[model samples]
Target: MVQCLSHRVELAFKDAMKKAPLYSKVYSLMDELFKFYHKSAKQSAGLKSSFEALNITPCTPTRVGGTRWLGHTLTALNNIWKGYTAIVKHLSQVSVTTGQSATQPKALYLLKLLRSNDVITFAHFLTDVVAVLAQLSKALQKRETCLYEVHQQLLATISNIKKFQTRPGPELRKVQRPDGSFAGESLTGDTTQHSAQMPKLLTALVETLDRRFSDIDEGVLCATKLADMNAWPASLEDSTNG
Candidate 1:
């Protein structure tokens, strides 16, 4: 650990002009901050808290089998992930009680959904991740594209449920004129009637989504911003040192 820390410092000072280049540029500052994060990850709670305070997201390098940063990320995320699964189970139980179909198995569905999705292009992708994450912890990023998509899906479902509840009830059809002729009554008369409180139920469902998903969006935005903040320094470092 000490050797890693020493090399890191030596490398920075070895090229101080290149790394900190007297300009006080925003990108340069971000570059320095990013370095601090890489080291902090291994040290103490300070790393996590500082990054959280700054709302920065640490970028795990893509090289396989390099440092343990990715492993730590997985660990941190898995802890949250476990809690997320429990939340899904709880929600599913509620769905069963209300006779609503459970969403396709949460983990598999989410993984499949992302297979056809882009991580950086659309905000909805971020929203979906955050919405799932919210049952456990809040993200530091906001994914409007993601949140908006969820909102749209939910709104559509609410509309369908509303129509189901409001279509002309059979009872109104049972009424007859003072004369002997009955109203146009379908003799089978056994259509499944929706609960009168369905509109209210639909409204409650929409409200719940609004509250829960809204927070996820906030988390996505914050997390993304943090990552960017951490990335800026690295970006500038690469550009200058190159």
Candidate 2:
């Protein structure tokens, strides 16, 4: 059986990002954050010195080029999600000290977006959804992976996504930061809109999986489990019957 290691995860992630509505805004924020960080580092040693003095290494966002493979997209998403707080902290300082609005309008806009409630919740939502797909993507690429395992993983992923969709309210409300006094930007009328669309996004993800892997046989997936010695039936006839 051929492994369908195509762009299933990539497509799902892309779809989720698209459905988010605010995804482009989040990405733009990351881009501006990195650009401002780089510009600051280059223009004034004070920026770099301050970061070092605080022992917080400045993080830059990785671009998720469509031409690149799935791993690149996952990496880019992870970079922004993981370094979110640090990016916010530095940019907040930059805004205060340098008047980011005059020097870099995009960065200023991004900084505002990052502090907003909708963006925070959406970011958390993406991180949770994409992280599961990322794990499955890595497992599927392994040389020894089998059809049955792929089937199992897909079902598990679908279930997890559905679970996420049902109760995304808390995730879309706030960002938890212990030290920072940053209040999230309120999305006003958008709160309900974002909550409503999450389920549809997850539904699309499930439909994509069903569409892409429809040719995979259930019988074959079941039988492939016998390949594991630990899971073999007691007798040959039992295995065949199952």
Candidate 3:
């Protein structure tokens, strides 16, 4: 099974090389994405806060509702749609913005995955995304005095968790500081404390940011070094599956 899949991947790459124009076409198409889809903006875009940009609130992923306000979540890919801006109404639905008939590379790739009885897609990442965005939206609704600071700290903790992978040890301690904040807590104080049971949500945000960092090349963002390094550590899948 592994050998067959490896051969398929090799064929895809070899065919892609032959059709270099096609590969470049797709690669160029993806160029615009990094400009709009940065780690700092993804949660905001996911929350789609233009409607009530100021009054975000705390809620679970199931309770959160802002998927409709952004118009098209895939708006970054404008050329594929022939410049038509269609709003995406559902998350689980296969995208409709790729202006192509049957058997288009991207569209068919997605369709094939959807039809497959046993396969996984990153779309499942959406589930983890909802909780993170919901928490972030709540922060935006109010004055964000410490979110950035806490969020950075959260990333560090996520790194520790990923690195350790919860090595066997004595009973985990509460590990709270004098300030009433959890020892490795990302956001501190009551502002972030009001509804902070969503550690899973925060972890998801960290992982998404990691993916964004993976896309950056020589640390340049429009001639500026956006981030020096990807600090999120190994992914959970690599830590466990590998």
**Number of the top candidate by lDDT?**
2
Angstrom error at residue 87, model 2: 2.5
Q: Which stretches of candidate 3 lie over 4 Å from their true place?
A: 1-109, 116-121, 137-141, 147-242
Clashes of each: 20, 2, 1
Q: What's the lDDT of the predicted structure labeled candidate 3?
A: 0.29
Residue-level lDDT tens digits of model 3 in 26-143? 2332332232223334332543442134233421121111232111222322222221111111111224534433313433343333322111111222222222333333333444
* lDDT string, candidate 2, 1-242, tens digits: 33345456666567655665777766676556555556664524544454566576644566555543456555665666556565555555666765445655554576677766556556666666666777777788787887667767777878877887656534333443443223432232234544566677778777776766665545665577566565668899998999
Clash number for candidate 3: 1
User: Which sequence of candidate numbers ranks them by lDDT, best first?
Assistant: 2, 1, 3
- Residue pairs with colliding backbones in model 3 are 150-186
* RMSD, one per candidate, in order: 26.6, 4.9, 20.7
Task: Judge candidate 2 against the unseen true structure and give its global Cα lDDT, from 0 to 1.
Answer: 0.61
User: Judged by TM-score, which candidate is best?
Assistant: 2
lDDT of 1: 0.31
Q: Please, what are the lDDT tens digits per residue for candidate 1 over residues 1-242?
A: 22232223223222321322221222222233234224444322443443355454532211112343323223433332223233223333333443333332432333222221121111121122223223112211223333233333434444543443345223222222233222221122221221222244335444544444454357553354343333355676786986
- Candidate 3 global TM-score: 0.22
